[model samples]
Target: MAEVDLSVQRYSAEVIAHRHAHHQLVLPVEGALSLSVGGRELRAAGLSGVLVPGEARHAFAAPDPNRFLVIDVPLAAAESLGAAPWIERAAGGPIALDGAAALLVRAAAVELDAGGSAALRRQWAGLLVLTLAERAARAPGREPAKLGRALRYIEEHAHEPLTVAEVAARAELSPGHLHHLFRAVLGTTVQERVAELRLARATELLSRTDLGIAEIALRCGYADQSCLTRSLRRRHGVTPAALRRAARAARPAGPGRGGG
Candidate 1:
């Protein structure tokens, strides 16, 4: 099995041209950095990032204070990430991490700093890679207009009680057609996608807020606290209370800043 090396680093005023043996994903957390790669100049700031293939020639510069989360994925693991694992340009592109990805990054960071068993760290890294791979594979830069609209609708409205028919209507497509569209584009069903969005919302609430379980459940489109508990355990092998505990424990003391 391949491995992932994860770290957060800050740099300033560096002019270096180098190639790595492992594929690299550089996510800018704070400030900005410019990379000249493959005869193209890419600048990443905030949640933007760039993926560099192994052995690619690249030079980078961060003129001011910049923080970035870097992940190096082994060749075998990169190959398993679908099509092309290396993304030439990710600045303001669909390959960029959204809010959901940001949440995962924070969770992964906590896991890395937990000083737990190696297996736990590896699991977190693996999951992080899997999510990036999935997002990359979607290639949202090339998404069809209809599918894009549908996805946006789900993201914005997952908190409400929703159904495939309602979502399909909002997307201006029939329920059956929307199902096909989701399966063809996202490799999942409409219902599954909605469930993912809802669960993601629930996870965010659980980890970041002090809301009660029942209120969180209602806000996440679940009927009640029991429903949320069952769903969380079924999918994450943890109850809402347990997840909250882990999340609160993982939180850093005082304000902190880092790249995604």
Candidate 2:
């Protein structure tokens, strides 16, 4: 049986090009990337996605540090799925992921980072492909314009102390309406999304930069270093120090520069 692989991946500043026999989906949770798929230029950011059909050559480069929930769907698996995969359903370009679909991808990234089981991730991969594709097909006006603004607001201000009310205010919605929308559309609460963004940034900085753990914590909106450490321990099962140590061990020692 063909298997689905799900993982959180990062790309360097270098533009790397490759092709595979299977389809791939790149869901951006953080920074942007310039992607070239079959000579079509696309931007992977602001809760957007890039769909690479089987054997379609693609190249991507990140201008800053980034994180993406990458799904590798084998050709046989795509062909075998009950529903046609997104690549088959859509025109094969940037997938217009709605607020909920983007949140789902973010949630899956959290699970993958925390060593979620392969069986569980495979389940998520299928849902993600379907949701993104379905959402992409919906009439553009049906998508709440405020939701996109809300998500972009959260991304821009995630580093500062935030509140649901503040985010709702930015999105021009009442707190109650914001909560309702988040639950009904995104299947998550605002608090969960805030924490997810904070932790994701914390992890990205931990793994990719030479910054101190305490500073990384401050930058990610944690109250302090211990707050950050406890959150990481609770969610990711590791401390910032341990995460950085692991990251360092995985790479060759050399001159280091900070990445966004």
Candidate 3:
């Protein structure tokens, strides 16, 4: 059986710098913890954690009560981590655990506490390794880094009059290259994505706010009410007014709806 160690730990103070002979994964469940790796500090909060490769010098500190799950995998089993072992550790960086990784880590933690069989531990450990390998392959510093930048730009600037050329310049790629990456990685063209984002925003306004269609159109990057109506009809098979009416009808009759 391979060497794999899993434990749930709580810390209130600082842990002296240390090096592990085996790779370690730390998953934060409650509170927050600070990890120091490669002369940098990483804040693991919410559902975020850190993966420190075997033989790497690292330390952890918890100003407040902190709880986390730590798993150790032998150097041989950690071959899947590839050449780069230490992930980026900026305080607010995107180095946190992905959804699949978080789920696997939590499941492994549960199995460890249940005193499961050795075979079960091996299986969970193997899965965890594979998931981490996938994350490492798509790490932000890799080939798709610019694509990630473009995605962030879209999410942040979708409400503006954004064009493919403008977004490509922001992402440091030519317009054609940006379009290619969008289609290849996201399976959608740049304009399609922007329009979809705008429509999504419009739907949110229609459902949550009483904003008029003309104002919502301006806010969602459409030229006017007609533009918004045309796009909504194309994408949702209904005009904005009709969609808003449907949304209003679907909402349950609240207590305020009672006749006095």
Candidate 4:
């Protein structure tokens, strides 16, 4: 526990519970994860991340072709988060980070995979934990349990043709209640949230991976590359190609690639 441990990992579909002496941050780099932290069921995907306190019981499962950035932080650095509402506060996630948190995890992954140093890894992990804690503290009130449930359903299914009715049913709420919940709690409509999720994922894939636009479109649930292009342009005012190019340019040149 002298250092924060960081790695990209995947899990089998079979559920398994893990309890560790160290706190853990489970964020998706590519796909979704169904996990429970201390009896609170949640899902982690692009912007939806899980923060597990030290010694808490957490179990998870995910589909194939998925990757997650798992950070194991020593309890000392993470102790400040021990008393937050792990269940309720996680509702608006996907926790209220917008798209930046997911991108940050991807950046950390690059350095980690290349065997970067411990100091940098600790900084990345600390920033992530601090953000999660701060947001939870800033949340207005106890998050409606149904809202959290609806968010989980959406994170797991937003890539498909989604409907408010479907999401409401999954959360065991009426469509009207779901609508009101989104407006009251999140201040956005269900469709908009789903769209935000899709586009956020599209942005991550375009900027991080070398995958083709069409494939990225499919993964993000767009009808085609053009649809994804339209959404990206409308929301972020950029094209997929331009996003990719900028990401590549901003990335630091890798070692062993230039003159020694």
Among the numbered candidates, top lDDT falls to 2
Judging by TM-score, tell me the better candidate of 1 and 2.
2
Off by over 4 Å in 3: 80-94, 138-141, 144-260
Worst 10 residues of 4 by lDDT: 251-260
Candidate 1 clash figure, as a count: 1
Off by over 4 Å in 1: 1-143
lDDT of 3 at 13: 62
Deviation in angstroms for 96 in model 1? 9.8
* Residues 1-260, model 1: lDDT tens digits: 77776776565565778777776777655456777766666655544467766777877777655556677777776556542333333322223455566667767666655664667655655666677666545534434455655765776677787789988887788898888666654567767666765676687678767999899999989989999899889989999999999978976554333322
lDDT-superior candidate, 2 or 3: 2
Q: Tens digits of per-residue lDDT for model 3 on 1-260?
A: 34665666666564667786666767665455677876766655543456676677877777554456666777655544442343332112323343445566677777777887767766776666556555445434543667656765775688898889888888898999888776654456778777766776687677656888999999989988899999888866998888888877865443111000
Preferred candidate (TM-score higher): 1 or 4: 4
Predict model 3's lDDT versus the native. Answer: 0.64
Q: Give the alpha-carbon lDDT of every model.
A: 0.66, 0.73, 0.64, 0.70
lDDT of 3 at 134: 54
Error at 116, model 4, angstroms: 1.8
Q: Over the stretch 153-242, how does candidate 2's per-residue lDDT look in tens digits?
A: 776788897899999998888999878776665667778877877887788788778888889999999989999999999987998899
> Can you write out model 4's per-residue Cα lDDT over 198-249, one digit (the tens) per residue?
9878887886679999999999899999999999898779999999999779
Worst 10 residues of 3 by lDDT: 251-260
- Model 2 residue 107 CA deviation (Å) reads 12
